[model samples]
Target: MRIQVSRQLLDRQLVDVDGRLVGKVDDVEFALDADGVPYLRTLLTGPGALGLRVGGRIGRMLVLTAERFVTDRPMVPLRIPYGLVDRVDSAVWLRIRAEQLPTSPVEEWLRRHLIGRIPGAGRAGG
Candidate 1:
């Protein structure tokens, strides 16, 4: 199915089959073939990448904050190759579960330092 790069594709949330929030489509990668024709290479996400695309001071702050989470000076965005996408609708669906991929450090940090501290944080309210 043909999907518009701007509207139906970009900025859409990516979810696993189990309905977990993985992340959003921050940016996309494209590559050229032997014929010199370029195609979508991968989907890039993570604060550093999203921030750079966003630009301005807000972007810098995002990168800086993300750096604190890990020992790496410059963080690398999660690259989901086009091959892994199972389907596209309101959002991008991954063929594999999120547990198979690396967890977001920021999400882990916040959950550990803040969210997890709250009482009954482990339960989901109906």
Candidate 2:
């Protein structure tokens, strides 16, 4: 589909069919074919990939912050293969629900150690 890369694509949140948030578009992956032609391979997200794309001090700080959350020194980006994408409009839609995919370690940690500890944290705010 013909889409305005910046407006219709970038920075938009990706959600699964069931309405679970996957992530935002941090970067797009590309693949080269036999003719040396490149095509969109996947959508990359998470603080690590986004930090590098953002660049400079701010980006480095973001990466470092994310790294501190996990035992690993470097945080890894989440990859959503292009084939799994169902459509693109105001936001990207995925064919499957987010629970099917691996959960972000940072998110799990926060929910368990931080958010879960607070009263009414389980409830969503309007």
Candidate 3:
């Protein structure tokens, strides 16, 4: 199916088959086939990709903040291969469930250090 990458893909919410939010389509990756045809490779989602796309002092701050949570100086975005995509409409739907995918490091850090520590954090709010 033909799709306008910028309009249909970028910034679109990514959802797993079980209806859990994975993340947004922060960036896209492309690869060339043996026939020299370019094709979508992966969808990148995470603070690092979003920060780089924003491209400014605010963007740099975002990258820095996320980086501090991990021992790795440079953080990599969560990459969802194009093959995993099941469909696209209001959101990009993946064939697998969210639990099958790797968790974002920045998200893990925030959940552990901040959000998870809050009272009632373990409970779903009304």
Candidate 4:
């Protein structure tokens, strides 16, 4: 199937099989076959990818802001293989569940430093 990367893929929300929010398609990875035909290899998500795709001062700030949360010098983005994508409709549907994916460092940081400090934050539903 033919796809318009910018129009259909980029900035689209990624939804797992369970309908859980995964992330957005911030950037993409491409590879060339033996025949020299380029193909989309991976879908990258997270601030790192978004920042790079955006580029310039605002982009650097975006990444720097997220980097402050994690001890890692350069934050790693969640890379979803194109093969793992079951479909791409209104949103990109994944063949796996969100639990199968690694937790975002930014999210984890917020949970530990901010959200976890909130009263009753540990409890689901009020």
Candidate 5:
């Protein structure tokens, strides 16, 4: 499909087959094909990718704030290969379930550190 990356993709929500909110399309990666033609290679999501895409003081702040909750190491954005995308309409739909994708580091950190401490967090719909 011929997609208008800026108008149709950037900032769009990413939903998996099970209809879970995975993340947003923070940035897109491109790679050259055999003929030296560029094609969408992967979809990147997370503060690290968003920060670079929105480079500036505001972007740096975003990265810094998210980093504060984790380790000293730099954050890594979640990468979704373009082939995994089932379709793109109102939202970018993935062919697989959210559970199949590698868990987001920031998300794991927050759940373990912050959300995990909250009462009733362990239960479903709590």
Candidate 6:
């Protein structure tokens, strides 16, 4: 299907099959086919991609803040193959569930070190 990347894909919210918020379409990857045709390879999401897209001082701050939680120097974005997309409407729906996708490194780090440490973090709130 033909789609206007900037209008229909970029900045669109990404959802899993079960309607869970995966992330936004922070950026996209393109690859060339054997026939020299260009095609969308993956949908990149997470702070890293967003920071890069944003660019400049504020962007650097974003990346640095997220990096503090992890030992890794550069965080990697969550990459969802374009083929995994089930449909595109107000959001891009994935054929698989969120659990099927890899968790963002920064998010994982934060959850383990920060969020997980808060009082009553293990309990459900009313």
Q: Pick the candidate with the highest lDDT.
A: 4
| Candidate 1 lDDT over residue span 1-126, tens digit each | 677888987899999888888899998988998999988889988997898998999998988989898776688999999889999999899998999989888888889999999999999998
Tens-place lDDT digits, model 5, residues 1-126: 899999998999999998999999999999999999999999999999999999999999999988886675598888999999999999999999999988777788889989999999989983
In model 4, pairs of residues that clash are none
Candidate 5, superposed: residue stretches over 4 Å from native: none
Q: For candidate 6, write residues 1-126 as lDDT tens digits.
A: 999999999999999999989999999999999999999999999888999999999998998888877677788888899999999999999999999898777678778889999998889786
What C-alpha lDDT does candidate 1 achieve relative to the native structure?
Answer: 0.89
TM-score of each: 0.88, 0.88, 0.91, 0.93, 0.91, 0.88
Q: lDDT score, residue 59, model 4?
A: 97
User: Residue-pair clashes per candidate, as listed?
Assistant: 1, 0, 0, 0, 0, 0
Please give the lDDT score for candidate 3.
0.93
Model 6 regions lying over 4 Å from their true place: 118-126
Which lDDT value does model 1 have at 54?
86
Structure candidate 1, residue pairs in collision: 29-41
lDDT of each: 0.89, 0.87, 0.93, 0.95, 0.92, 0.91
Q: Could you tell me which 10 consecutive residues in candidate 6 have the lowest summed lDDT?
A: 66-75
Candidate 3 residue lDDT tens string, 1-126: 888999999999999999999999999999999999999999999988999999999999999988988888788899999999999998999999998988888778899999999999999876
lDDT by residue (4-85, candidate 4, tens digit) is 9999999999999999999999999999989999999999999999999999999999999999988977988899999999
Better of 2 and 3 by lDDT: 3
Q: Which model scores highest in TM-score?
A: 4
What lDDT does model 2 reach? 0.87
Query: Candidate 5 or 6, higher lDDT?
Result: 5
After superposing candidate 3 on the true structure, give the runs of residues whose Cα lies further than 4 Å from its correct spot.
Answer: none
Stretches of candidate 1 exceeding 4 Å from the true structure? 117-119
CA shift of 23, model 2, Å:
1.1
- Residue 53 displacement (Å), model 4: 1.3
> What's every prediction's RMSD, in angstroms?
1.7, 1.8, 1.4, 1.4, 1.6, 1.7
lDDT of 6 at 11: 99
